[model samples]
Target: MGKMIVRLWRRGFLSALNRGGDPHISDEDLTARARHLAARRHLVAEDGQTELTHALATGLHAATELLEEAGLSRRDARDRAGVAFLKSGQNLARWSMRLWLWVTPDPVGHAKAGNKLAERARMAWGSGLTVHQENGPDHATLMVTECVFVDYFWDAGRSDLTPILCAWDAQWMEIVNASDRPVSISRSGTLAQGCEACDFCFKRKAKLVYSAPFWDRLRGPGHGHG
Candidate 1:
């Protein structure tokens, strides 16, 4: 898990740094920063959530610092860092969903596989994520009472970044459940936003006229019929 966080942080941090347009950040500096992050393997939280939260926060902080050094104001630096973090999360989710689809072959199966893996991970890491699932004919509702990410970030006094992390849940769901029926995730409350719990409602909406397969959509035009 520590190694995984290090790898994720390295990917996000380097991607953000390269795109941040900071003249002072060189190849040598990048290597040094990677080393610095890797050396903090001891910072891995018992629940695994704080480890990832800290890693993402570190990446955002690095981006904000670089942008600030490049003459951006605090607000501008944070905004840019947020964009970079969001892009990194989306890229990671897309890659993960593709890999899951390759293994599971069907979207529903892929989603179930992912849910099982996530549940196992939470149990293994003692993440304390509580959920209630309701299955319907065409949709499912998952209500989460406790989230490790929210708990960790709030405890670490970095609650400001929790929303950024929470945003990845929707991004991942969209990627994994991409379908003609408009699979959607709706959340009303989150622990990060001072709510008691997070309510994730995943539902399949009406089908679209021009819905395309996930792979075709991912590959863009010229690969599938319009």
Candidate 2:
């Protein structure tokens, strides 16, 4: 996840040159593209909602694609994705506090950045931003948020399942993707069968499996079985 964030940041910055807009592509344009892509497949919302508007559709589609491609187990993917969203300037007026902290050492600068990021995230998400502790450095959570935001990229279709699966994983629920049943969780919290479809899932399956006992032990004494 850490590597992915750095990679995305670098790609976003480089793309900004020819792409125009902010450090990343404009969210409006991206949303438009998402709608177009989704429409072609006749995707519909869960409740038979109207097709996505051309204006907001593309950006939503792009966000979804980015998340799906990020692969599950990239714990930080959400936060990083969120940062990228902010960079596009579609959600808020400025970069997030984490961004400021990442770039500078001053606590005040970090606070300012954090407030800006939080404000934008709330605006984009409607409700206040929800925070979750990802299993890595703080940046991991930011990337995960960004990845989740990508779900807006496409209209709901079969593809919508990608985000749904991601959400379950994001919440650390025992749900399975590409399978209908709950995945086997060992005595430890790790999954017995990895989600092969997820890049990170596939990569970390072994390690997670091996660490199951430790994870289980780390869970408070009375926590559910891993």
Candidate 3:
């Protein structure tokens, strides 16, 4: 409805694109959309950090309005908008290029893939993190919760495994617990496809994986950070 509100909506839309959005759009086009949304929100600049200043309450209201306009019920709009912002903020971090990548079949595969990633990450970044499974409320998406807080940076990748990233037959539920503080939890796993069929392909993408401390320090409320 208002210009600022529209900008907020655009930011959410850009986030979806960053998280392996529709395959139809080219990377260049999606980058343009992301920049445009950021510009409208006064979040982009020639130099310096792009920060989100609006109160959470304001963002919540705007997102609710937009979602309802799109035909979702009032309650659904609020929930969806809330999660969208949480995820979009993570997208912003992704665009900022402050995080690294890690891939494995799922949390269960953590024992196998995580230890290796942790070892290399610790050697490279100074800390190691563990993956913890987290369950969501009934209405939210199902996922495996991995905690990257002990010595990490952040995670901004997609949970989908098909067209983008191609991690696995995984579904993810991103958990955003704090606004004033930095936090993100992304979920992924294959519902229809098991790890056997998708394991090899997933490991290949794991090449982009990051060091463990890269994620640990950035993940929790208790962890110390720079």
- Top candidate on lDDT is 1
Off by over 4 Å in 3: 1-51, 55-57, 92-226
lDDT of 2: 0.34
- Supply the TM-score for candidate 2: 0.24
- lDDT by residue (tens digit), candidate 2, 1-226: 3334333433453343224332244445454556577577555443211221222233434553555464522333334444443344321222232232234322222323445434443444332124322222121122123332233333344343334334333332222122222122222121112221122221112222222233344665776234
lDDT of 1 by residue, 129-167 (tens): 777555555555566778755765565455665677677
User: Which one is best on TM-score?
Assistant: 1
**Candidate 2 residue 134 C-alpha distance from true site, Å:** 29
How do the predictions measure up, each by TM-score?
Answer: 0.62, 0.24, 0.25
lDDT of 3: 0.33
**Number of clashing pairs per prediction, in order:** 0, 43, 22
Off by over 4 Å in 1: 1-5, 23-44, 47-50, 61-72, 98-132, 176-178, 205-226
Q: Candidate 3, residue 209: CA error in Å?
A: 20
